[model samples]
Target: MAHPVDVHVGQKLKQIRTLRRHSQTDIAQRLGLSFQQIQKYEIGSNRIAASRLFELAQIFDVSPAYFFEGVNGANDSEVTPCNTSTTISKALAAIEDETVKTRIVTFIEDISGMAVGRQG
Candidate 1:
Protein backbone atom coordinates (compact mmCIF):
# COMPACT_ATOMS: atom_id res chain seq x y z
CA MET A 1 0.00 0.00 0.00
CA ALA A 2 1.13 3.54 -0.63
CA HIS A 3 2.27 5.48 2.40
CA PRO A 4 0.10 8.38 3.47
CA VAL A 5 2.91 10.85 3.11
CA ASP A 6 3.64 9.59 -0.36
CA VAL A 7 0.00 9.86 -1.35
CA HIS A 8 -0.22 13.39 0.00
CA VAL A 9 2.87 14.46 -1.84
CA GLY A 10 1.61 12.87 -5.03
CA GLN A 11 -1.71 14.65 -4.66
CA LYS A 12 0.10 17.93 -4.22
CA LEU A 13 2.17 17.25 -7.30
CA LYS A 14 -0.90 16.57 -9.44
CA GLN A 15 -2.70 19.61 -8.06
CA ILE A 16 0.10 22.00 -8.85
CA ARG A 17 0.70 20.49 -12.24
CA THR A 18 -2.96 20.79 -13.15
CA LEU A 19 -3.09 24.37 -11.89
CA ARG A 20 -0.18 25.24 -14.15
CA ARG A 21 -1.93 23.53 -17.08
CA HIS A 22 1.03 21.35 -17.82
CA SER A 23 0.48 17.97 -19.36
CA GLN A 24 2.28 14.95 -17.96
CA THR A 25 4.32 14.77 -21.14
CA ASP A 26 5.49 18.32 -20.66
CA ILE A 27 6.87 17.60 -17.23
CA ALA A 28 8.24 14.28 -18.30
CA GLN A 29 10.17 15.86 -21.16
CA ARG A 30 11.59 18.55 -18.94
CA LEU A 31 12.74 15.94 -16.46
CA GLY A 32 14.03 13.62 -19.20
CA LEU A 33 11.72 10.85 -18.06
CA SER A 34 8.81 8.95 -19.60
CA PHE A 35 5.25 10.09 -19.12
CA GLN A 36 4.59 6.74 -17.47
CA GLN A 37 7.09 7.69 -14.78
CA ILE A 38 5.27 10.93 -14.21
CA GLN A 39 1.99 9.06 -13.97
CA LYS A 40 3.47 6.72 -11.41
CA TYR A 41 4.71 9.65 -9.36
CA GLU A 42 1.33 11.32 -9.51
CA ILE A 43 -0.43 8.14 -8.35
CA GLY A 44 2.01 7.55 -5.46
CA SER A 45 3.08 4.25 -6.96
CA ASN A 46 6.62 5.60 -7.02
CA ARG A 47 8.28 7.79 -4.46
CA ILE A 48 10.00 10.93 -5.59
CA ALA A 49 13.59 11.49 -4.57
CA ALA A 50 14.48 14.60 -2.60
CA SER A 51 16.59 15.88 -5.48
CA ARG A 52 13.77 15.37 -7.95
CA LEU A 53 11.35 17.01 -5.60
CA PHE A 54 13.63 20.05 -5.49
CA GLU A 55 13.66 20.08 -9.27
CA LEU A 56 9.87 19.95 -9.34
CA ALA A 57 9.71 22.87 -6.92
CA GLN A 58 11.95 24.84 -9.24
CA ILE A 59 9.76 24.01 -12.23
CA PHE A 60 6.58 24.96 -10.38
CA ASP A 61 8.07 28.10 -8.75
CA VAL A 62 7.16 26.96 -5.26
CA SER A 63 9.09 26.02 -2.14
CA PRO A 64 9.99 22.38 -1.53
CA ALA A 65 7.81 22.43 1.60
CA TYR A 66 4.77 23.16 -0.55
CA PHE A 67 4.49 19.46 -1.37
CA PHE A 68 4.38 18.56 2.32
CA GLU A 69 1.87 21.13 3.47
CA GLY A 70 -1.21 19.79 5.33
CA VAL A 71 0.33 16.32 5.56
CA ASN A 72 0.23 16.07 9.32
CA GLY A 73 -3.49 16.73 9.62
CA ALA A 74 -4.55 14.87 6.49
CA ASN A 75 -6.61 11.69 6.69
CA ASP A 76 -8.42 9.54 4.13
CA SER A 77 -11.53 11.58 4.77
CA GLU A 78 -9.62 14.78 4.01
CA VAL A 79 -8.61 13.55 0.60
CA THR A 80 -10.79 15.89 -1.35
CA PRO A 81 -10.40 17.80 -4.58
CA CYS A 82 -7.52 20.09 -5.37
CA ASN A 83 -7.31 23.40 -3.54
CA THR A 84 -10.56 25.30 -4.01
CA SER A 85 -8.74 28.40 -5.15
CA THR A 86 -6.95 26.43 -7.82
CA THR A 87 -10.18 24.89 -9.00
CA ILE A 88 -11.92 28.27 -9.09
CA SER A 89 -9.03 29.84 -10.94
CA LYS A 90 -9.06 27.09 -13.53
CA ALA A 91 -12.80 27.33 -13.99
CA LEU A 92 -12.65 31.09 -14.32
CA ALA A 93 -9.89 30.80 -16.87
CA ALA A 94 -11.96 28.43 -18.97
CA ILE A 95 -14.78 30.88 -19.47
CA GLU A 96 -14.51 32.24 -22.99
CA ASP A 97 -17.26 34.81 -22.53
CA GLU A 98 -16.10 37.92 -20.76
CA THR A 99 -19.58 38.88 -19.52
CA VAL A 100 -20.16 35.49 -17.96
CA LYS A 101 -16.73 35.52 -16.38
CA THR A 102 -17.29 38.95 -14.93
CA ARG A 103 -20.64 37.94 -13.51
CA ILE A 104 -19.12 34.88 -11.89
CA VAL A 105 -16.34 36.94 -10.32
CA THR A 106 -18.80 39.52 -9.11
CA PHE A 107 -21.02 36.88 -7.60
CA ILE A 108 -18.10 35.33 -5.73
CA GLU A 109 -16.87 38.70 -4.49
CA ASP A 110 -20.32 39.71 -3.34
CA ILE A 111 -20.92 36.51 -1.44
CA SER A 112 -17.42 36.50 0.01
CA GLY A 113 -17.64 40.17 0.97
CA MET A 114 -14.36 40.56 -0.85
CA ALA A 115 -12.71 38.79 2.03
CA VAL A 116 -9.07 37.92 1.50
CA GLY A 117 -7.45 35.16 3.48
CA ARG A 118 -6.11 31.66 3.13
CA GLN A 119 -8.83 29.09 2.57
CA GLY A 120 -9.07 26.33 5.13
Candidate 2:
Protein backbone atom coordinates (compact mmCIF):
# COMPACT_ATOMS: atom_id res chain seq x y z
CA MET A 1 0.00 0.00 0.00
CA ALA A 2 1.19 3.47 -0.72
CA HIS A 3 1.85 5.86 2.10
CA PRO A 4 -0.82 8.45 2.75
CA VAL A 5 1.62 11.26 2.21
CA ASP A 6 2.55 9.90 -1.20
CA VAL A 7 -1.09 9.62 -2.14
CA HIS A 8 -1.79 13.18 -1.07
CA VAL A 9 1.20 14.51 -2.92
CA GLY A 10 0.21 12.65 -6.07
CA GLN A 11 -3.30 14.07 -5.94
CA LYS A 12 -1.90 17.56 -5.52
CA LEU A 13 0.42 17.01 -8.48
CA LYS A 14 -2.45 15.93 -10.68
CA GLN A 15 -4.50 18.92 -9.59
CA ILE A 16 -1.66 21.31 -10.34
CA ARG A 17 -0.99 19.69 -13.69
CA THR A 18 -4.62 20.00 -14.66
CA LEU A 19 -4.68 23.62 -13.58
CA ARG A 20 -1.69 24.34 -15.80
CA ARG A 21 -3.62 22.82 -18.71
CA HIS A 22 -0.83 20.37 -19.38
CA SER A 23 -1.39 16.84 -20.52
CA GLN A 24 0.44 13.93 -18.94
CA THR A 25 2.63 13.68 -22.01
CA ASP A 26 3.49 17.35 -21.76
CA ILE A 27 4.46 17.08 -18.11
CA ALA A 28 6.38 13.90 -18.81
CA GLN A 29 8.35 15.58 -21.54
CA ARG A 30 9.09 18.60 -19.38
CA LEU A 31 10.25 16.37 -16.54
CA GLY A 32 12.25 14.14 -18.86
CA LEU A 33 10.12 11.25 -17.73
CA SER A 34 7.80 8.83 -19.48
CA PHE A 35 4.06 9.36 -19.44
CA GLN A 36 3.80 6.14 -17.50
CA GLN A 37 6.08 7.59 -14.87
CA ILE A 38 3.86 10.66 -14.65
CA GLN A 39 0.84 8.43 -14.28
CA LYS A 40 2.58 6.45 -11.60
CA TYR A 41 3.43 9.62 -9.75
CA GLU A 42 -0.14 10.90 -10.03
CA ILE A 43 -1.50 7.61 -8.74
CA GLY A 44 0.99 7.33 -5.91
CA SER A 45 2.29 4.06 -7.29
CA ASN A 46 5.78 5.56 -7.18
CA ARG A 47 7.27 7.69 -4.49
CA ILE A 48 8.61 11.06 -5.66
CA ALA A 49 12.13 11.81 -4.54
CA ALA A 50 12.92 15.10 -2.84
CA SER A 51 14.85 16.37 -5.83
CA ARG A 52 12.02 15.42 -8.16
CA LEU A 53 9.55 17.14 -5.87
CA PHE A 54 11.63 20.29 -6.11
CA GLU A 55 11.56 19.94 -9.87
CA LEU A 56 7.82 19.59 -9.76
CA ALA A 57 7.49 22.70 -7.61
CA GLN A 58 9.43 24.62 -10.19
CA ILE A 59 7.38 23.21 -13.04
CA PHE A 60 4.17 24.04 -11.23
CA ASP A 61 5.43 27.52 -10.35
CA VAL A 62 4.46 26.90 -6.75
CA SER A 63 6.47 26.96 -3.57
CA PRO A 64 7.57 23.62 -2.11
CA ALA A 65 5.36 24.45 0.85
CA TYR A 66 2.38 23.94 -1.43
CA PHE A 67 2.96 20.20 -1.45
CA PHE A 68 3.27 20.10 2.29
CA GLU A 69 -0.08 21.74 2.69
CA GLY A 70 -2.27 19.58 4.92
CA VAL A 71 0.65 17.19 5.36
CA ASN A 72 1.77 15.95 8.70
CA GLY A 73 5.45 15.19 8.75
CA ALA A 74 6.78 11.70 9.50
CA ASN A 75 6.42 12.45 13.17
CA ASP A 76 2.65 12.57 12.58
CA SER A 77 2.42 15.16 15.29
CA GLU A 78 3.74 18.09 13.31
CA VAL A 79 1.13 19.19 10.83
CA THR A 80 2.40 21.55 8.21
CA PRO A 81 0.61 24.81 7.75
CA CYS A 82 -2.10 25.02 5.12
CA ASN A 83 -1.23 27.38 2.30
CA THR A 84 -4.37 29.19 1.16
CA SER A 85 -2.49 30.52 -1.83
CA THR A 86 -2.33 27.02 -3.23
CA THR A 87 -6.08 26.71 -2.97
CA ILE A 88 -6.43 29.85 -5.04
CA SER A 89 -4.01 28.49 -7.59
CA LYS A 90 -5.91 25.21 -7.75
CA ALA A 91 -9.18 27.07 -8.19
CA LEU A 92 -7.66 29.13 -10.93
CA ALA A 93 -6.73 25.92 -12.75
CA ALA A 94 -10.26 24.49 -12.74
CA ILE A 95 -11.63 27.55 -14.45
CA GLU A 96 -11.63 26.98 -18.19
CA ASP A 97 -13.32 30.18 -19.21
CA GLU A 98 -11.05 33.08 -20.04
CA THR A 99 -13.60 35.56 -18.76
CA VAL A 100 -13.68 33.77 -15.44
CA LYS A 101 -9.93 33.91 -15.23
CA THR A 102 -10.00 37.59 -15.91
CA ARG A 103 -12.64 38.13 -13.29
CA ILE A 104 -10.68 36.17 -10.74
CA VAL A 105 -7.55 38.06 -11.48
CA THR A 106 -9.35 41.35 -11.12
CA PHE A 107 -10.89 40.26 -7.86
CA ILE A 108 -7.54 39.20 -6.51
CA GLU A 109 -5.99 42.45 -7.55
CA ASP A 110 -8.74 44.39 -5.85
CA ILE A 111 -8.32 42.40 -2.67
CA SER A 112 -4.58 42.89 -2.74
CA GLY A 113 -5.03 46.59 -3.22
CA MET A 114 -7.34 46.71 -0.26
CA ALA A 115 -4.80 44.84 1.85
CA VAL A 116 -2.06 47.21 0.81
CA GLY A 117 -4.23 50.18 1.66
CA ARG A 118 -4.89 48.75 5.08
CA GLN A 119 -1.19 48.17 5.65
CA GLY A 120 -0.37 51.69 4.55
Q: Candidate 1 lDDT, tens digit per residue, 17-94?
A: 876779899999999999999999988889999999999999999999998877656464354444675677678778
CA shift at 37, candidate 2, in angstroms?
1.0
lDDT (CA) for every model shown? 0.82, 0.78
Predicted structure with the largest TM-score when compared to the true one? 1
Error of 1 at 80 (Å): 8.7
Task: Flag clash pairs in model 2.
Answer: none
Estimate, for each residue in 1-120, the C-alpha lDDT of model 2 and write its tens digit: 877677778778887787577899998998899999999998778999999999999998899777766777666544453346557777787788999897787777777785455432
Of candidate 2, the 10-residue stretch with the lowest lDDT total is: 77-86
lDDT of 2 at 68: 63
Runs of candidate 1 exceeding 4 Å displacement: 73-120
116 Cα displacement, candidate 2 (Å): 6.7
Candidate 1 C-alpha error for residue 90, in Å: 7.5
